[model samples]
Target: MVMEIVCPAGTPAALRAAVRAGAHTVYCGFNDETNARNFPGLNFDRSEMREGVDFAHAHGARVLVAINTFPRAGDQSIWHRAIDDAKLSGADAVILADAGLLDYAARTHPGLRLHLSVQAAAANADIINFYAGTFGVKRVVLPRVLSVPEIAAINAETDVETEVFVFGGLCVMAEGRCSLSSYATGLSPNMNGVCSPASHVKYHDNNGELDAKLGGFTIHRAAKDEPAPYPTLCKGCFSAGGQTGHLFEDPVSLNAEQLIPQLQKAGVRALKIEGRQRSKSYVAQVVRNFRAAVDALEAGRPLPEGMLARLSEGQAMTTGAYKKTWR
Candidate 1:
C-alpha cells in the first residue's frame, strides 16, 4: 500500500486547505495546553475541531488529534479531557507521548486508535514494542535522531507501523525532551509549546549590525543587511569548541521528499509534515506538493524537483538525520 501523507493543520482554515490539497491525513490539536503546539491564534476549539473533522472526513481525509505534551503534576484532567474531546470530534487517532497517559487512554478509550508521538522518542524497536505491548499503541512516530539504516533495522524487528517527519523544520534535540527553552525562558516546547517565543525576543542595533536576542541570550549577530534567522536556541550560532557557528543545525528546513522510496523500503507507513505553526497557504502548498510526490511514487514515476524551494525557510533545506551523514 502507498504510504499515507499526513499534514499538519494548526487552524480550521489550514485543515480545509490540507484536505483540499489531497492530504491523506491531517493532524491538529485542541486550543489548549494539553497539546505541544499550543500557540496563540492557532489550533481548534472543541466545536471547531468537530467541524474540522467533519470537513476533512467529507473530503476523504482522516484527522489525528495531537495531545502530545506531558501533563503537569496536578493537571492531568485537562489532557484526559482533550483526548475525550478528540474522540467526540471524530478524530481517527490521537498522538500521545507520556506513558501514564497512554495507559490511561488504553484503559478508558480502548476503541480509539493510538499513535505514539515523536515527542516520546521511541527510536528503538525494543521501546516501541514495549509501548505497543503495554499500552496497545498502534503506531510510532520515529524521532529524527535515527539514520535510515537504523530505521530499516528497527522495522525488521517490529510490527507497529512507523511514521516519519519528511518535511518542514527540524529539532536538534530529542523532541519533547529538550528543556533548554524552559531553562532559558520558563517556557518550553513540551510545557508551553512556544520556543524562544516572540514575547521574549529582542532585536538591537549592534553597531551597524543586528543582534537577535532570546531570553537575554545573544543568538544571532550579523551585519544589519544580512538575513537573520529566528532565535531558536538550537539553530543559534554560538562559540562552542573554540568555534562560532550554528552549533546544532543551520537555519534550514527539512526537505526529505526525495527519500520517499527509501523510507517506504524501510517500512514506514506514513510521512508527516511538520509546520503546524505555518500559514494556511503554506500548508496547502506543501500538502499539494507532497501529495503529488506520494502519488508519483505510488505510480512508479519520477519525483518532482524543487516544488517547494521558494517556500522553504531561509531558502535552505536539509535531509536531516534520515541520511547517515547527519549522525
Candidate 2:
C-alpha cells in the first residue's frame, strides 16, 4: 500500500492546497494556544477550521486537529473546548499529548478518534501500547529518536498505526519533553505551542558581525555577509568544552525521502512533513513530491531522488535518528 502523505496546513489556503496537491491527510492546529506551531498569523480560527475540514472532506482528504499541548492547572477548560470544537468541525481525529486531556477526550467525546502526538514521546512499544489500551488511541506519531530497526521492532510488537516525520525541520531533543525553550524564553513548547517565540528574539549588527539572540542570549554570530540562522534553543551555538558550536543539534532539516521504502517496510502507516510555518507554495511542492514518491513506490517504480534538496534548511539534510549512526 502507498504510505499516507500527512501534510501540515497552517491556514485555510494551505489546507486547500494540500488537499488539491494530493495529500492523504492534513494536520493543523487552532490559532490559540491549544496547538503546537502557534506562531503569529499561523493556524486556523474556529470558523476557518470548520470550513477547512469541510473542504478537505469534499476533496477526499482527512483532517487531523492538533490539540496536542499540555494544559495548565485550572485552565483545562481551554483544551477541552478545543477538543469540543474539533469534533464539531468534523475533524477526522484529534492529536493529543497530555494524559489528562487524552482522558477527557476519550471520555467526553467517545466517538472522536484520538492520535498520540509525537510530543507525547511514546518511543517504545510498551508506552505506545499503554496509551492505546488505556485511552484507545488509534495511532501514534513516533518521536524522531528511533532507528528504522527500532521502529520495525516497535511495529512488530504493537498493532497501533505509526506515523513518522520524513521532511522539513528537525528536533534534537525528545518531543513534548524538552525544557530548553522554557528555560530560555519562559514560553514552553509543551504549554504555549511555541519554542523561541518571536517576542523573545532579537538581532543585532555587531560592527562586522551579525548576532542572532534569543531571550538575550547570543545563539549564532555570523559574518556581515553570512545569513543568520534562526535562534531556536536546541539548534543554537554554544560553548561547553572550549568549543563553540551547535552543542545540541545543527540547523539541519530532515529529508528522509530516500528512505520511504525502508519506512514502509518497517510498517509505517504514514509519512509526515514538519513545516506548518512554511508558505503555501512550499507546502504544495512538498506534498506533490511526497505523494508522487509514495505512489511510485506503491507501483514498484524507482523513487525520485533529490527532488526536495533545494527546500531543505541551509541546503543540508539528515536522515535524523532513522539510522543508528546518527545516535
Once model 1 is optimally superposed onto the true structure by TM-score, how far is the C-alpha of residue 244 displaced, in angstroms? 2.5
Best by lDDT: 2
Clashing pairs in 1: none
lDDT of 2 at 287: 98
Candidate 2 regions exceeding 4 Å error are: 205-208
Worst 10 residues of 2 by lDDT: 222-231
lDDT scores in order: 0.89, 0.92
Put down candidate 2 lDDT per residue, 1-327, tens digits, no spaces. Answer: 779999999988999999999999999999989998999999999999999999999999999999999998999999999999999999999999999999999999999999999999999999999999999999999999899999999999999999999999888777887788899899978899998888898988889787888888988887877556767888887887888888888888898999999999999999999999888999999999999999999999999765787777756789989987835
Error of 2 at 59 (Å): 0.6
Model 1, 158-236: lDDT tens digits are 9999999999888888777887778778888887767767788898886878888889999888776766666788778
Task: Please give each candidate's TM-score.
Answer: 0.95, 0.96
State residue 82's C-alpha deviation in candidate 1, in Å.
Answer: 0.6
TM-score of 1: 0.95
State how far residue 224 of model 2 sits from its true place (Å). Answer: 4.4
